[model samples]
Target: MIRARQLKDWLPITKKEIEMRGWNEVDVIIVSGDAYVDHPSYGTAVIGRIIESEGFKVAIIPQPNWKDDLRDFKKFGRPKYFFGVTAGCMDSMVNHYTANKRLRSNDSYTPGGEAGFRPDYATVVYTKILKELYPDVPVLIGGIEASLRRVTHYDYWQDKLLPTILEDAPADLLVYGMGEQPLRDILKAVKSGVPLSEIREVRQVAYMAPHVPESPDWNTVELASHEDCLNDKLKYAANFKIVEVESNKWQANRIIQKVGQRTLVINPPYKIMTEEEMDASFDLPYTRMPHPKYSKRGPIPSYEMIKFSINMHRGCFGGCSFCTISAHQGKFIASRSEQSILKEVDELVAHPEFKGYISDLGGPSANMYRMKGKDESICNRCQAPSCIHPVICSNLDTSHKPLTEIYRKVDAHPGVKKAFVGSGIRYDLLVDDFNKNNQDGNHDEYMEQLVTRHVSGRLKVAPEHTSDATLRVMRKPSFKYFHKFKEKYDKIQEKHSLKQPLIPYFISSHPGCEEADMAHLAAETKDMGFRLEQVQDFTPTPMTVAEVIYYTGVHPYTLQPVKTAKSPEEKQVQNRYFFWYKPEVRNWIRNRLTKLGEKDLANKLVGNTYSHSGNTPKQHKKNKSKRR
Candidate 1:
């Protein structure tokens, strides 16, 4: 079903492509840190397509060389309106380094799965280059890197508190969160002749000015200045509480923070996008493939993974303390109409590479599609960061009927042999012990459908941690609910005579987790006959409660001291518990736990059966090599 595509199908990425379009100058030039993949899953493509859909000439410069003469940036020359800069789908530092700050060998967004294409602090680096080359031209920055760093935050890679990204990048403006609505607003104003620096009324944007703009229409909340935060950690921690609360609200106040002489103004975000607006963004004329320029370099790993997948919705209401989804995507869900989703399904099925298998059809959380508060007025007056945390909201609608119908319809498609839900599901939502809103037995029906049809042999979920103390600090439900959910999942499996296992994800060295907590987590999951394949050592990224706690040694919401493993040795010791089944580390675990007076916990893990031998280690290594 695939056909030869014209060069003009995608947004222009090269000078020749722009020339082919017969445009003398482009209205916008997007400089990105990721290889240009013309898919809705990629932010650069979405923004570029939005610009083109708005009737502006937009071209992209993907992964421009920062070390060279900067010709890649200059290739497009100056855009007629402004230069759009993004550090791509992920933050540059996160993409470049591992949790231990070791350099990563591969970049998923790069062709051939290679690293070293994008520099560290890519947004700042790219913007600096553009500002130096074209000082008179305006530069605008957005994406996860800019959105999460819009306020003063702790940069884990640098191991220090940093000011707003606007100060470092020196861009004219920043459009935070999902940029569709704010981007359109800016485009309209610019087309109407409003200067970039003068358009200060757009929502979901942050910019620096000499003083606060006078706006009587909205209330403003001033955060601790960058200087004050450097002098006092508590002040910095306090600032995060305000930022997170306001970010999740319906009618949020404008946030202003002083950084040196200039004031960083973060306008309140736009209300969650309606169904129509969400559809328009996804319904753009995306070629649904990487630009032809990268065909010789090899496939982009991230693009290939999601090429056939569809994102049914946006945003997450879970608001886990360690996560950035609710921070960057907001707390409310913006779902696409089923018509738009099916339309994409048809397009995906036509791809030559799609062999009747859809990789995934999910969003931030798989089950959150078409979910939101039932009463608008109640949501408008609420300020809580999480909707389903602590307890599900009374006015919120948690019905799974719409999602079940969508799945059934997709399964009925003759082109699709199977549609897998690869995205991690929020298992806590389906547990009757935790969620009281499922009185209509929608939960049972949905679980049956999902377990029977959607699971790809192993269904993935995140219990995060087993310890109640650690789970409380993480703002997650009790692990007891996970046990309940597993029981139900097992029953559903038995009913269908299926053999799909639940893959529960866990974290070590999180903000409130201790060495003993990880020990308990290992033993608990081990009792359930799990080898613990999915696990990670926590990395403190910017704009999350865990990061703030890791830096300040206290909870932002309660200001209570919370213990965190900081030193490399301490973190390594905690992480070892996740792999208790490995014989190589059993002796180490036993010794460390006994030293900490946790011999009982040690017995549960190593079971007093591990002993170090002079030649056993060599024999074990030889056996491992033979298997390989």
Candidate 2:
């Protein structure tokens, strides 16, 4: 392992850095919406490092000034191969705005957590600037914004169905999903004297074509036209079902869709990375620090949060309807070898800033490391979006032994004082009694180890909602599983004589969740003695099942109509339930419940006579009618 001090600095971000590297011109220039951070967690850094590993000269122009004379885009001039543009680690709109459509005051990706570093629709804006400045240079767009908005889909901010982003951004190619493999192929093809226009056969890439030509070798599924989706909501809902299913499959068919006169063909993504490949990607020589240019601007909040953390794996199998991890990272889990993880731990120990405490040793889901299908052939042919939702698939291997062992090994390091799993844990995976077939009776062992060692007074898990109906719509398991897991967790804490808290996360204003449902959730959790602090009003981002339901009024999978809180008043009403314990919201909650003729729930939530001390009366009036 490379010692932290011996690691090379960040990639060239300016002409001086390029000259320092003894290169007059670069082969590829990456324009990003985020401030340049040379950590593996940053997408631009990873892509740049991968290209550099291929012996290609690469440089980044991060969060460039697009409002000026377009000098930033011209600083790097034209690349020998292509100009790679990304809206950074997050979707630009999500980074810029809140769920309530209010402009966010801070961007975590920017240096010093400043706002307005990148413009709205950053991918489109950057690509347009590069194309206009260097029209002859081919531009390839990737990252979350381009990946999620590759095809015609709903745009919640605009409140309409917009066509493929390619229609708006004049780019030659769109590399979607985790882009290491496809990018390597694209680079190889470019090195072989192949034009960008003719490199359409690469996987995980989408390109605009003059016409829809027949492919005799590959099977294709054509989606509803952009015009049809724009004209009809039902057609739009149906199109998302195909897009989602194709995206999750192991061997997906090539998808073709038309937006106006152009035909957009999105090839299937590369298969899940092997253990060696995942290790190699993480093992790349990353300085793991923000660029020195931002030293005077104060530390990046996001970087500080995870500087000492280790990402054990990629992707999620939970496939929660409201989440987009599966949409971009794929449902299959790609984990690093034990050696790779330990090497990173050693590197962290050597860092001058690290104080022997590792912030996180987890990924999308903490306990899903080294977990996958029991049979390779079964997984290859499987089209299920989630391996552990609704019910854990019988073919899935949900053992926690591997993860527990890794934790113990990391803790055994003399240089490390503690290693926490900061990512949200899928509690259902620990319910061995509940999921008998998939588990190996090691649930208690894993739970005890985690609560006794890793947790720092609190462990977070997402139950999402209390209502079974809403959980189904969210593609989450029943709340009963949370109760079961909580029982086990409490038992383990008592055994260890520990006082750790099991913090459950929930979402308000989710699809299929009514105002009454939110009230029920509040009452149920209150009975369990929880004043929820980790709750959010559902944000409808692109390429999520809940977003599709929110925009189209129908579930993509079942064409069944779903009710969503769209209006500001409607969403506010749902959000109020999350704060039922607050004195200010108690009266409003009672009034809304009384109007809905749920007097029993009203009294249960806030006593007939509410108090201002943030506490409900000990004795409450009983209702004549039985509870619904």
Candidate 3:
């Protein structure tokens, strides 16, 4: 038995540190692709801390040198219980390469934000290395990479349907989703002397077996076989539809897909964490700082950005086709109690580095803290991926009072001078025209509170695209809703005499979006006095409906053909529209729009006619009207 160390600031990493803690053997050794950051926002730290809280001896090996003589894998020898492998917070391929398949020069998760610290497919690499060194030790993989790739899915980098990570890595188990509940269950089963091989009943876990196990308790849903998907794109598309629906359901059934001779079984996920459970997870002792070892190497950019931020909930019901938050975090909101949130705020106030400011008090969506389905039975029976998309669900409680109250409580902190909602707000929720059945009828109050108190200088919201056709494909509401939201936002700003900018974020080159659509977006936003400083070219990541459409050229739900900018040139041309004001791109935009027979759009975007003040005459008049 390993003697437990008195709770240390961070988990032990080196053998010397392990020995100093009086641990001859650790129950779990976590191997990660990211540099160690002992903050709750970082997954490795959270998981390591949770395991330590369970009274198990846990140590971490972060950014292990996979190219070396395998010393990192052998340094800890074999953990007594299991080795947890993760590709850090992001998928490894996404971390290593750009959407255009070009290698990135920096990784924000690293100590110095440098790239190439970890290998491509870091989860598979680390787990395979561990298994090669210690075949007897159990290896379990988790994190964003494993969670999104837990089933047969399209790999954008590889441009093929890859089997689940379980088939690729020689791991005994794979944990998916938020991981806290499933991890606790795994720890309990393992502590009870259940062999890792036989721990198949744990929820949110996946493993391979020679044949499907007979479990009378579970109702299993088999997906398209890996062979069938490989042979036919339609089968592959159809399979994703099943996987996505099962994933978002409240009471999901077990999912099984055959891969060659073995059967891949994914146990249903744990129910959404209750308020108490969410509070408990956040209340776990966290230093909320990067491990001291990275002091000289420079700060992890990702950690620095959110060190002072507080996550109020876990899950996004928006279910944007391009986003994986719902798939990984779940569709329901698991919010922290107000007390728990206030306690965290108080702790931030006491931190030596704190400067009378709480960076952010938000989650996946800032205003979704306490929002949920008004009727529990309706939500349980519902399989819709988004509660707000297409239209806000009638059963969803779109009230923002609870969120506003939380903001008020945080702002009331004597030590906190300001608490900003850095996360993007679902503007549709606050628009009366968009959310017609808002039960609380406090949309104006919520918007007023957010704009006057919570916003630091600018409030950010994602309109994504202006085209209703593309917006529908993206699972986002119509752009008209955004216009209504902006009208309300501008009215509030004028009423309060505040000059806070309502920044809207947009995406270019998303699935089903054409260059013509992007040009229209650029023209419309420009007409509305937006130069579009916040914009991104859509990069298809794994396990998103957008990615499925991008790779397969078909919508997963309807099996209809969808157009995507596949080539670098196609994507670049679409992205150029976002920067029509730039001199270098002005001619390029004019020529492209002209070539596409969109002369009017080109004139709107980059017409020669302009006022001496460098503003178009029409734009000047529109800006003047806004001042009135």
Candidate 4:
């Protein structure tokens, strides 16, 4: 049977079980979900790769068809340890994430429905199947998806931060933070015959049944801590979210989750990769072949049509409130040499289907390449996760020389018509690239080319929100600066005769956003004629700044977020900001506007609403606000 036959994609060991525990030919199987849509890259792929590198036998089950019977995995036999690593989903959970946000939920299935065949369920399903196949194997679960789901997180669809996935999904142990070093330690400990009970004390790992309690035995806070009694406890509870773990500047290791609460609070383990380790990890002999695993499947657009992924660096320096890149990838931006990028582009140009378009090249922020703290040793001593910025750390490097050269070389390549940057460009950094006046001539020139020539239709940017008050809460772009950027882009488009438009990406229903806040945004949109087609509602993925806002109604770090109505009705109002006409919203907007004493603006809003024609959801949300 196909199930019984040897597996091709994942690095599975023998398909037959070994006789005894020690005699078991294998010690563990690291189960990882591929962030590499095409496989052989990203998330678990890297974790598994690193494991195999350590001389341990690790079989990476790339992307399993979650709908299939969990029993099929029994064919691969069992390992002394089973490690579950996911990029973002287990069973159908990954597929459920809406790529195209337009589709609304029908009655058949709900977006926040926790009990179905999700990753956690699939973890259990597979665990049980493994048990039936080989009784004593241990399954360890961890990854961002599981890490966040470790405890209750804010569920946008349900309008609350819910509880840990562990209670529901039967995982034996959980690796809470970045699992690299932690998993390595786990494999070593397990293969050496460490008992499960004894393994509980390891930092960064939260097991289901602990051999010993972390706190004093008498410190038990009841099975259903104050959380279970809340009217919406199941909806807004946190399982394992870690805030700042220590007073130390070892940022990654310091910012952590509260133990066993089902939150994703811990950061990746290391603060810096030794020069040699960084060189070895990135400078591997990577050939530009279709990732070996996916090549076996026929070519597809996401794989073949794209050129080099061109990772210029590894970490991020920005702590944009809405993003996890810096927290997850860490803030240390390790860049590749200029020669490396030039070679990759040459290869891209040589590809048979090479159009003049060189595709995209980016990493973290794409700008902070080979940057270090001003005083590396001292900066390491200062434990704040992000540099307070503008004050200057001794270790941080704000210079863009290395990055600029790479950009120049790629653009100069023979077959390259344009080199796009899919990675985000930190505009705030750009604002500072010049001589303290928010204008840098050379920075402007290169950035203009990158945005206008490269971004195919529009340069996408996330300003998150436009209110000065909200920006502070979000720890990001100032409304004043973003407005200036809109003006700058307009002038640039006119000056360069570029066809690209500014694709400003916005989010609706973030923790601090209110109906009035959205209304204010709509008014700004009307004034700017900014017809935004893309709107993202917040998804409080476990262990994020956003989740903390939903839970305590306070920033877990700072204890402040403007109270906004988080109800569905309030969200619907915000969703309509881009639209100009909808009768229900129109009426509500007019009434609300009149009460706010903006009679003249209300009339103008009505006029604008009437001028727009369509009655789609977007349209209604708009007109309703204008009229109100």
Candidate 5:
């Protein structure tokens, strides 16, 4: 443990000073400047836990009701060690999703559009506060927000992932990749009298300034001289191929360098931590919650929300072209035992506000549980996250038994009125079951049991798009199949005398999606009647093929070119499904429907006046004219 008086001033302290604090002593205090909490965006929480596991006392401070004053952060007690800081999840929302994704939460809350989007997020104010206070606190910034926007990229708001975040957060060390392993290595090295500058050579830690003086031509990059810097602005900033140094470090790139003194992007080819490591990390005491501060809130984790999330499994075998779950989670599954889930459930139920309902129970695909590789050895390393919305990889066990049984046990509890499966279940997996096609099919029998007996009324399913071409791109089940399942579900509900619906979600502007594709989806929804929640203008997330396509307009997998949706008018048209009923929107929809031969939809919209419009451009213009 490194002990010091100030930020970046943790010089070689006496062994007595280090020993003065027991193994449980906190040499540093970590401040997590996060915007919100959810599973997957748990970068800060994991870091805090790992540091604690290493015998360092760590406190995580929540900035939800956060004041923009740095003085507010002084409550966690002064650190005799170091402070870690981040730009929070909104930075990720800006970097990974379209800038509009940040607008999503605000949109969700605000009924008239503003109500339901990112709220309480004052990045500018928060960052300015950080800048003013603790100017010398050796701050560290990381997470998707910082990683993706560490340098300039295509930021939608500013129209690019400009150097804005770095400029604002002002981190001393910009740790990227999976930060846990890198952080420990960094802290240890610094404790060993290594300067932060010397620690820059470590893999996964992206530091400022170039390591090498010049760029090595890719073809000429030698293995021993593996560290080459890039000079080109875009490529330089993106030199993150520092793979884990495995038995075979040369697994992916033979040479990872280009022009410009960019930096040696470490894509460590090392095999990720084994299954035991993964299990140990995830299987930690579920009872442990990183106390944001040693204090009490009025009430915690509302019935509608959960404080921390426990991942049910690792890896998604489903290889959807546009998804990165496979890239991040891997292409295999390592599910936790039913017993573990029960333990988590017990903890949740024990929460003083236990209302017998968990906000959600899920993994990559809520349905995939206990999937493993053929060999136990490979399974440990095969922590791949399967894509749930589209294709279910052949390797993945699409068995619903384990999950259904687990759900039944969870739902059967007297206190729990509802157990929602928030993660989208794979629709294709359902088709494989007998119930997908036959109302009297065995699969249908299971469906009846699950839906009537186990499932909450609104079971969420992601049929990303309706058009076959679009489905093909999403690698998802087609419109024909989704409808078949819905029909079966409807019949099963009728038979069971239950009221439940397979509420399907759709995404617009996924890589291959187009105006015509969206038109097809609109038609499908019209026929289905007041059904289908749509995700408009899919923004590419980090390491996702879909995002690559969204950026390059070229299919990452097939190298094929696709027609992209860029026009504001096009986005607004498709968005009408989410915000349907704008008269101008209605006119646009009617015109679109008329063009697509969806005459009934066109007629219905223009005739009945669905009346969901808020303030349309036409309305705004008209109001302006009246004022004039």
Candidate 6:
């Protein structure tokens, strides 16, 4: 690891830093909505470092003052190639507001966790400023905000469908997904004297043109135009299904959409990165900390949270409907080699702030490391969005031995006391009932290893919802599988005499979920002795099945109507079910359930009966039955 001991080590964030590097002009000046953190986890740092690795002078203007006289956009002057803009690691709207559409007071990506560091639509704001200042200079947009919004989709915060970000941002080019492969290709082409607008054939890129460009190499799929989607919501829903399937394919078709008179062409993404390539990306010269400029302001909450953690992989195959992992990272699991992961572990242990503990050795889904199709040819032709949903794909190799081996190797590090899997696990993969492919008992071995060694106090898993109908819409397994997994988990804990609790995450007000379902979830979980602490109200974001349903009132896959709680009152009623244990909400729950004619469930959840031991009603009943 190349530690940053001086300002010169980091990529130039100011004009003086550029002068310090003896550069009159940079090849690329990246404008980001996040504070400068030279960590591998941060997208701005990754993109900046990648540009530097390619022997280009790159500087980042992070969290530039949009309200000011636009000094930050002009700090490094116009780049030789183009300006790369991103709304940081998160989509700006999601970062700025809660699910309830309330303005958030803390920005985790900002120094001191203060709000108002960046505008609402940060990428659009930054790109517009750059374009206004230098109309001749080309602008490139990427990162989560751009990648997910590359096509016309729903914007929950705005409560309306917005066209491709290109329509508003007016960037010359957009690099979607992880951006490394596309960025490299674009840079090399620019170095070869090709203009950004002329470099059209690169994979994982989107651009606007008067008409669709013909490519013999890739078959093209024209989506419903933005105007058509606006006129017909079902057409919009159908468009989403196409976008989702194409996004997950190993060999995908180039996507074309009509935004207006101009056509938006989105070339297919690059294939899954090889182990060596994945290693190279993670093995970049990152300082693994925020820039020194923020030393007095206060620590960035997001950076601090992942400072000591090691990401083992890049993608998830679970493909939960509500998640954006597959949408941005793709469904294929591109995992680092063991050497790369262990090297990161070594760096983490050596960091000054590390306390002999590694915060996480995980990715989008912790247990999905190094998993893929058993048949390469099968994966190439498959278009299914999820690998282990509905039923675990017969072609999938669900072995846990590789991950277990890596965990053991990580534990063997002399300086490391514990390396926890902080990322949420796909718990269904562990249940033998759900995953029958674990013939060698590797799941048991891995579970024992994780519970015995990795967990700090609790391990988090997302069952998502309890109702089967809701789980189906969410692309999750039934709650019965959760019960089976919990039983096995309890057995393992009992056998080891360990007390670590299993924290299951759930969502309220999701599409297909009703107040009654939430009540049942409350009663069932209360019976399981859990007052759920990790619950969330479903917030529809762009390019997800749930979000599409929320806007269109129909399942994108089935094109059938599905009820979603949209009103604040409906959402609040669904949410209150999760807090039935609170004395203040018990009466409210009783009244609501009584109105729903679910008096039995209401009594099960917030009954008048109480015990001195403070056990739940069901548990108290069990104790009474034992006495009898």
Per residue, candidate 6 scores C-alpha lDDT tens digits across 162-214 of 99999999899999899888888999999999999898999999999998889
lDDT tens per residue, model 3, 53-104? 8889999999989986678877877788999999999999988887678899
* Candidates 4 and 5, the one with greater lDDT: 4
**Tens-place lDDT digits, model 5, residues 1-628:** 1122232122112233234443334456544444222223255556665666665666544442344335445554344456666545434354223425444433211112222122122343344454456555455666555555443334444433333244445455666544655777777776676755445545444444454433232222322221221123223222222221111122333223321343333333223445456555655432333232212422222212444334577556565655545544445455666776676666666666455666567777766666544344544443232334444434334455666677778777665677666666766666754222322343444455567755655777777777888777676657787877787778777887888666777777676777666765765676687444545467655545455455555654445676767666666666665434445566666667778877775554444333335344567567778989
For model 6, the stretches where C-alpha displacement exceeds 4 angstroms are 1-4, 609-628
| Candidate 1 regions with alpha-carbon error over 4 angstroms | 610-628
Better of 3 and 6 by lDDT: 6
**Which candidate tops lDDT?**
1
Collision pairs in model 6 = none
Q: In candidate 3, which residue pairs clash?
A: none
List the lowest-lDDT window of 10 residues for candidate 1. Answer: 609-618
Cα lDDT tens digits, model 2, 1-628, are 3443421378989888887788878999999999988888999999999999999999999999998668888887789989999999999998888889999999888888999889999999999888888889999999999999999878888988888999999999999999989998999999999978789888899999999866665689999999988888898899898888889888789999988888999988889989998887888988888988898998898998889899999999988988989989999999999999999999898887788899898999988999888898998898888898778888888888888889999999999999988888888888865576543566667888899999977999999999999999999989988998999899888988999888999999999999999999999999998999998999998899999999989999989999899998999999989998787888888889999999999988877755454443443222212222
Best model per TM-score: 1
lDDT, candidate 4, 470-512, per-residue tens: 6666666566666666677777788878777776777777777
Off by over 4 Å in 2: 1-8, 610-628
lDDT of 1 by residue, 274-337 (tens): 9999999999999899999998999899988898899999999998999999999999999999
RMSD each, Å = 3.1, 3.9, 4.9, 7.7, 9.1, 3.8
Model 3 residue runs over 4 Å out of place are 1-7, 608-628
* TM-score per candidate, chains pooled: 0.97, 0.96, 0.95, 0.74, 0.70, 0.96
Greater-lDDT candidate between 1 and 3 = 1
